[model samples]
Target: MNRTISALKEWLNPDWARHRSVPPFEAGLRPNRRLDEGTALLPEAEFEPDDVVIRDNGEVVFSSGDGIFTLADGVVTRVATLGGQVGTLLVAEDRMIAAVDGVGLVTIDADGAATDLCTDAELAACVTDLTLLPDGIVLATIGSRAVPDWSAALVADDRSGRIVRVDGSRAEVVAEGLGWPGGIENSGAGEVLVSLGFDHRVERRAVTALAKAGTAVGTNLPVYPGRIATCTDGWWVAAPYARNRFTELLLDEPELLREMTATIRQDQWFVPRLRCPDPYTDTLQLGQLRVHGVIKPWAPARSYGLAFRIDQRGRIAEGVHSRADSDRHGVTGVASRDGRIVVAARGFRNLIEPQKDKER
Candidate 1:
């Protein structure tokens, strides 16, 4: 009965009822209708993939909540288990580096031996993503120190995120007071681009300018951006989950959010999730109702998949999407190899190749 009343109140609220508008696609761009048509590289893996990287030897390695795994020729092999949540994966020459929840940055060799590259003092918080530079330097993004969970960090909205530079186990803060930093990648122009998750944009900063302010590169993205990877022509940015209109409305409702955080489970909270286990029977947000046995793909997407290609100038070149009605949601990581773009769709627990040539 309480759930029904809450749903009724959400339905009646004017701010919550209003749908979040997405800007129309630019010229030469269209929505992706067949995002699930690609092949699943790891069909048997049960863990949620967070990031993927292609090694120099043509091997594909991905990090999941369980650990790091490698896929080659339809075979999946376990590399190493971190005993904690793994956030991102990076392959540097012969070493595989990963960002772990409680373990900080770790390196896994070819023999699956795990070694600590950076400890809690270097990270001082949860590490989300890392990038390998040409000169053997590492750039990482720190999400928050108060909470180890990403969802909890978002709910707290403390703005304690930052970017750090790690060299030979030594780490230094390059930028501070960010809004849930997610992805990190070199911009090829003496600067690194980072995804500000809660800010809904990407920013670029130089490594030497530790205390200098950064400039926004990609602004007003529709979804929360995750990992950003360099491609042949430019960079690929992943939007893991769609923005929730109801949640946006409640951002200023501090008392309500505090109560909900105290009472509701992390997975059950009305936030953007990677997967929807029981969308039909679960508590509905304002615009996510099933009407007459029909669920619209564009109506209040809970876990939508989206990726964008941006040119060197940071303009969005192309995009692909999997709507709320599709199973290929939560695209967190993207990589390009030999002219093929591969994405880690965490919601579906598979690797997908977004059809870039398909037109509207």
Candidate 2:
């Protein structure tokens, strides 16, 4: 059987010796129109949000290149301008902390006064997500050190991603050689759950033993997980993009991947984006597929949007999706509070509140 399987692999992917393949989306992560059933909770805009958090005062805010902004009474308002693009936001003790591009992490208080927390030279960029541990330590996932951004890092198969711990003015890398650690969250049990994008799994590690790669809580995920926020029962995880079999095949052929990267426009690369911007040119004609809303990729939606929940023990709870054919792609952030769920469909440039939202 082993020989037959190997022979089949050779015959199917003859050009590549590596056995790279896409994980199945079954069980709790199955595809559905749950996200499409959702309503646009916030007014449409070009904010290009990365993460959103419900403040202690019951204010809804999100992180974007334009900085932190609040949404209330169906109106969006900027609360602070951190002087650079923001990656993630965390609310702690009446103040908000954000990962600002080129500036490290900055704390914004009630008055929107921005103060630098950790300006470590290494973490000046590529900070993916942030979470506060029970012991007050702040953990951050550095997507990669080899590339300036995620697209380049994934294309180059970069493995410099790390988990950094921040204590007041000190910041140090405790875990290294990660596969695009895109999301971080505290486990209420004193452990931390990290979503490994390239590895396609969620790992659990002791805050003290982060030097270890930890154990898998969820493995062989179908989507590249992103920012995760604690929910009433477990945690809500965002998937900015979904896996593509063709892309996986392309990845196994390094020479071909290299040549394509060199010759093709970055925008047209077989990579995921916030949305299928130019339907005509996008590997998939999502625009044309929407007969009234349906279909996927000429290739899959490099524009897939998804979010799921994992129980405290890392068991899959439930999930939702925008589908490759849908414009609601790149769901990078999710927050649930006061019976209301807010999802940042960054690709769609909108926030979604599923039909199940009780508050609204």
The sequence of per-residue lDDT tens digits that candidate 2 reaches over residues 180-298 is 99999988666888999988888888877987878998877777888889887888989898877767777766788999899998888887667877666755322334444545333
Candidate 1: tens digits of C-alpha lDDT, residues 4-44: 66567778985654233444445422566546666667764
Candidate 1 TM-score versus the reference: 0.87
Quote the RMSD, in angstroms, for model 1.
6.1
- Once fitted onto the true fold, the runs of candidate 2 whose alpha carbons sit more than 4 angstroms away are 1-18, 284-299, 357-360
Error of 2 at 81 (Å): 0.6
User: Ten-residue segment with the worst summed lDDT in candidate 1?
Assistant: 20-29
lDDT per prediction?
A: 0.77, 0.81
Tell me each candidate's TM-score. Answer: 0.87, 0.89
RMSD to native for every prediction? 6.1, 4.4
